[model samples]
Target: MTLIEEVKAIMQRSASDEYLNVMVPLLEDYVKAECNNTFRKNGKTVYPGGVKIFIAKACEHNLTVSGVSSKRLGTVSYSYDLDFPDSLRRLLNPYRRVRFHAF
Candidate 1:
């Protein structure tokens, strides 16, 4: 299945096609950025299998947490993470690239 289809399946029927159309590519880019693009072998770029699933999950996460940052009901409070989730970070760690800069 395509990435968007996977995302739609993950979401169990999303209400907005336009939102999916726009955000799926953006989330894919985010996943690529987190992985530092892709691994190049013999001048050919190769992507791992996990990336597509990661993008789909990330899209679901983004949809779930969009707009609201924090909330309070009485003394209890909740905070929504606006950044890339740590759980997702852990999943992508194997593909992550660390860059060394010379200053």
Candidate 2:
């Protein structure tokens, strides 16, 4: 599939070229980084599911729609988090791209 087709299918619509330009490279780099080596076979993906993996990951990273915030109580006890969801990890797990950490 072509870039436009992939973007539309993944993003659920046709995003701007500028938006795609940014995310496509980011997606490529992210997969390569996760592979910890190469993510290619004969100038293409080594894995058949590679494109879906990239799409899922890039979509996860692109969840930029802001949530509503309130300071109604007149206190300063506000918090924000941007942790990745478990579903996303599950989606990438089959590709062995799920990051693990020691803490």
Q: Which candidate tops lDDT?
A: 1
- Kindly report which residue pairs in candidate 2 clash with one another: none
Report the lDDT of model 1 for residue 11.
Answer: 68
Candidate 1 residues lying further than 4 Å off, grouped into runs, are 10-15, 39-47, 65-69, 72-80
Backbone clashes in model 1, listed as residue pairs: none
TM-score of every model? 0.64, 0.57
**lDDT at residue 84 of model 2 (Cα atoms):** 46
Candidate achieving the largest TM-score = 1
For residue 70, model 2's alpha carbon misses the true position, in angstroms, by 8.1
Stretches of candidate 2 exceeding 4 Å from the true structure: 50-57, 60-83, 97-103
